[model samples]
Target chain A: MKKHNYSAGPCILPQEVFEEASKSILNFNESGLSILEISHRSKDFVAVMEEARALVLELLNLEGKGYQALFLQGGASLEFLMVPYNLMKTNGKAAYLDTGTWASGAIKEAKAFGETVIVASSKDANYNYIPKDYSIPTDADYFHCTSNNTIFGTQMKSFPNTTIPVVCDMSSDIFSRSLDFSKFDLIYAGAQKNMGPAGTTLVVVKEEILGKTGRAIPNILNYEQHIAKESMYNTPAVFAVYTSLLTLKWLKKLGGISAIEKINEAKANLLYTEIDRNPLFKGTVLKEDRSAMNATFLLENQDHQELFDSMWKKAGISGINGHRSVGGYRASMYNALPLDSVQVLVDVMKELEKNS
Target chain B: MKKHNYSAGPCILPQEVFEEASKSILNFNESGLSILEISHRSKDFVAVMEEARALVLELLNLEGKGYQALFLQGGASLEFLMVPYNLMKTNGKAAYLDTGTWASGAIKEAKAFGETVIVASSKDANYNYIPKDYSIPTDADYFHCTSNNTIFGTQMKSFPNTTIPVVCDMSSDIFSRSLDFSKFDLIYAGAQKNMGPAGTTLVVVKEEILGKTGRAIPNILNYEQHIAKESMYNTPAVFAVYTSLLTLKWLKKLGGISAIEKINEAKANLLYTEIDRNPLFKGTVLKEDRSAMNATFLLENQDHQELFDSMWKKAGISGINGHRSVGGYRASMYNALPLDSVQVLVDVMKELEKNS
Candidate 1:
């Protein structure tokens, strides 16, 4: 059975990227050395890091700025703790937008460091809508927002325009859209979503935002330590970074973020439109706040949820089950997910509707 | 032209492992979904984690203890902070043996959280050998040591046997040999060197040692949190962990750690013998203290370093260059390095000796 992956993360990656990465894992660049064994500092692997960093900046259209790109270990979860540890100064407060599960996690980690003000929250509505009109405190060190909520399928389409440096946890939506680089002081994403695989976290931080946090940060958790040492403060996740670089190269060949955004938007629309039009199903997240990365919906007849799930699983649809916390269906439309895959999902939904 | 991969890490892996891992990356388990796209919470992945954890215990021959195995994100670098966060609460002090770079890192992080005592240090000898004769703090929380110095190529053959809990950062040499697990209260290794890849860190800790640390630790960094959640406290580095699971399974099939130890010993002897026999090169670390994982050496003729490097490079040998701080050569003989590869390196040295 041919299966189409719709998991929110550790999600689909480009075929070319996988092929290239697989070859290198066994014998990197025909060096008769496994990619896993190569030193992160070796000229070959250094080129891998350099190219990976460059591609990220190139993808973001922020190549020359003082922004330092790092391919560090620990997923976005570590970043949750690291963000505040590096930026939260003595008795400093960081504002966070509690959009979904990941946002809550970020908030939890920050609270351990210092006071964190929840600028906005969508939990009241079961995270079906994005809240607006939250006041950003001028005194807050920085504002943190999750660019896209993987579980809730809500995205911050427009970033809050504030003088306070904006930090984003774009674990899912990065590289699926275009953004003005000037707005974000720091941006980080776990590679499982739209990039390559798990194991590497991409951190893009403005060089100037660091050194303000007076707290003596642990070197491993300290972002400035990584920046100053160029992410080689220790041996990095070499294979993951190398695979990510290949993915980034693939994205560039596809005309960077702009071309992918069009594909992503089209895929999301195809799934969302079917959900809205189909009487048997209803979109979970508000129509205005529907995500371009993850389209979530619930079957009208809850009893048929299992049937729908079983039918889809039979149709080779994997990871369509909504997060257990949010019981429904979620079709993650990351960059590598082709429109045809989404169409297959839509076709499954329509056939079920027709049979019913 | 073939290349030999001698890069320290993200280093060499078995060809079979890469082949199997690559197949799954593109179409996992014939699901037609990329392994990267699967949810860690999914039954398939949960099985991977469970099996991987079980294999670790099985390989270590540590069974029927109140111990927990975790596949954690963040390298041992993160654990440098986490070790103290979870274990340093009793307030007397934790003893650490300062071996080399990573040991120093752990020491630096431990100092920030609580009182840390350096019981022994090899820095007096420029980290060329492991220290001997150290007073294990009688009332200390735990004793810590780096098992092998990847940069310096030294291994501690015997640990300081004490009543107080013993913690070790076995980042470089984990499966390289067999050991009595009862001696150490805690052991952790970053996966890059021996098991698989660089994204995941393996932690084995006795459950009782946790929660004694009075300091409130970040949930993700907390050992208790990972234990309670079975290393699923957060979204883990899924693919890396999965690959690690594959490697563990492969290790078990190859007769576990015991079989690999003999092979490691043999390979290390071959290279070290070459370094000892040849007048052109000399092993850097002391004879008895040399590491089975990383073998460090210095060229007698420094001027011919580049010539030797180019020759090695042409022989498909990669990552043979030593650390900039050390300025010589280091051929890391990690667990995955085949004896044949070592023989090839030895042959090249012999040819070089004859020609020189």
Candidate 2:
């Protein structure tokens, strides 16, 4: 059976990327040595690191924009700590927009360093919408926000025009849509969704924004040190970085973000259209704030939950069960999810409605 | 031709592990979804994480000792910061043994937290031998040391007896040899070496040693939080953890640490014996302190460098070039490296001598 993996993260990547990555594990680059066994500093692997970093900038169209792309380990959670350590100064303040769990988590870490302020929060309504009417304090070291909340199915369509350096956690929705990436001082995403697999995190930071914090930041957490070392300060996640390079290559060959954006929109629209139109189901979040990457929806009658679950499982759809916080279903339509899979999901929903 | 990979950390894993891991990337556990696409929360992957953690304890004989095994990211370098964050108390001090590059790196991070005392250092002699006659400060929060120095090819034969919590970075040596295992309160190793690949790190810490530090550790860096969360504090390196599990299963099937320890010793002895007897080459580090995992050696005549280098390359040998800091050849024979490969490398050394 063909499985349509809608996993939130460590999610679906391009099939070609998987094939290449799988082959590399056995014999990387025909070097007769598995990618798993090669040194991160080897010329071949170094090319992978360099290409991955370069392609990130190229895909984001941030070439020559004073941004350094680093493929680091520890996922975006570590970035939560690093962002404050590198950006927040001594006794400094940071403004964060609380949209969902990850945003609150980031704010939690920033509080350990200095004063952390929540500019606005949609938590009152279970984070069903992106809070747009938030003001960033100009004095705050940086205004941080989660571009897309994977759990709540909310995405900030337009970022606030901020003078204080802007940092965005694009963990789930990065590279799925076109954005003016240069507007943010730093953007980080775990490579599980839309990028690659779960071992690495992509950190694209503007060089000028660093080194101003004056905090005694640990070398491992310091962005400038990682940049100076060309992301080789320590042994990087070699397999993860190489697999990300393969993914980035897949994205580039598939016409970059602009091309994937249309496909993603189509996939999200197909499933969301079925949810909103079918009398048996409804969309979970506000229409405007609904994430194009993850579409959360619920059956209109809780009684039909068993039937709906069985139908999707029979249809070979996996990972559609919504996060426990938000009950129902979440169809994560990342870049690699084909429109055909979404159509299959929509067909299942229609079948459920007919059965009801 | 089969290649002999000795790339140092991020080095060799078993061929069976490579095959299994490669297959999982395409379709995990006969499930139509790639392991790369599966959720960490999924029963299958959760099992991987659980088994990997348990196997670490089981293999190390630490299971009944109240130690929690965690698979983390950012490598041992990040653990350099995390160890102090979770162990060193506010305004407390730490005692360290400066063995080689990684030990010094750990010491550097420890200094950022509080007072760090170096009880002994082998740096006066280019880290050719482990410093044994040193007193660890009883007042220190913990005593730290590197079990093996990958770059300098030195290994600690004995650890200092101390009442303070003993922490060891066994990145290059863990699982390759059998130790008392209970002597150290905390042991961390980057998975790239004998474990699996370059992405996740294995941290086995005694539960009693945590949370005593009055310092407010960020949740991500907090070992207790990770332990509480069952090592899935956030999205783990799903693929890395899974691959490490595959490697662990391989180790277990092959008789775990005690069994592999014998094989590792044999491989190390084969190469070291050749380096000793061959007139053309000499070992770099002191004989008493030579590492079984990584053997460093130099040509007796530097003029034969080009010839020896070519001979190894032609014989399908790779990653033997020594680190720049230590300008000699380093052959890292981690647990997965078979005795046959060591014989091949030894054969190359003899060939070089014949040519000389």
Give the candidate number with the greatest lDDT. 2
| Model 2 residue A325 distance off true place after TM-score fit, in angstroms | 0.8
A42-101 in candidate 1: lDDT tens per residue?
778788888888888888988788898998877898899889988998899999999999
List native contact recovery per candidate, as a fraction of 1: 0.76, 0.95
| Weakest 10 consecutive residues of candidate 2 chain A by summed lDDT | A267-276
In model 1, which runs have C-alpha deviations exceeding 4 angstroms? B1-4, B90-92, B301-316, B351-356
Looking at model 2, the pairs that clash are none
Error of 1 at B331 (Å): 2.8
